[model samples]
Target: MLQLKVIQEVITLILFVVFSLVFFKNETLKWNPIIGMCFLVLAAYFIFKK
Candidate 1:
């Protein structure tokens, strides 16, 4: 149950950023956010890396 919740949160975070980048023309992808997203993805990877 806990693992599922963590996965969902990570996916949600990624999707939110992706959707924002796709739908919001005014919003540009900056370096800081990109780095943050990379870290988030890494966290997700570690979580599932059994």
Candidate 2:
């Protein structure tokens, strides 16, 4: 179960990056997506740190 959670988190992070990159390419306001993802990654890392 723990391993699955870790995998899900990693996949979520990757999707966030890909989504942000694709969004930014076509829209200017997509910066929020990238910033949001960065914060999410930071929070997730700290929260899950062992």
Candidate 3:
């Protein structure tokens, strides 16, 4: 249950950023957000690692 929650949160955040970039033209992708997304991806990787 905990693992699922963590995975979902990470995926949701990543998807949110992606969708925002795709759907919102005024929203620009910055370095900070990109770095943050990299961290989120790392977190997701660790969560799924056995």
Candidates in order: C-alpha RMSD to true structure: 1.6, 3.5, 1.5
lDDT of 2 at 33: 65
**Tens digits of per-residue lDDT for model 2, 1-50:** 76567668767878766787697786554677668767766766776788
In terms of TM-score, which candidate is stronger, 1 or 2? 1
- Comparison by lDDT, 1 against 3, better one: 3
The local distance difference test score of each candidate is: 0.84, 0.71, 0.84
The lDDT leader among the candidates is 3
Residue 45 Cα positional deviation in candidate 3, in Å, after optimal superposition: 1.5
How many steric overlaps are in each model, in order? 0, 0, 0
For candidate 2, which ten residues in a row score worst on lDDT? 25-34
Could you give candidate 1's per-residue lDDT for residues 1-50 as a string of tens digits?
Answer: 76788788878888988899889979888899889878877877888799
Model 1 has a clash total of: 0
> Scored by Cα lDDT, where does model 2 land?
0.71
lDDT tens readout by residue for model 3, 1-50: 77888778788888898899889989898899889878877877887789
Give every collision pair in model 1.
Answer: none
Q: What TM-score does each of the candidates earn? A: 0.70, 0.48, 0.71
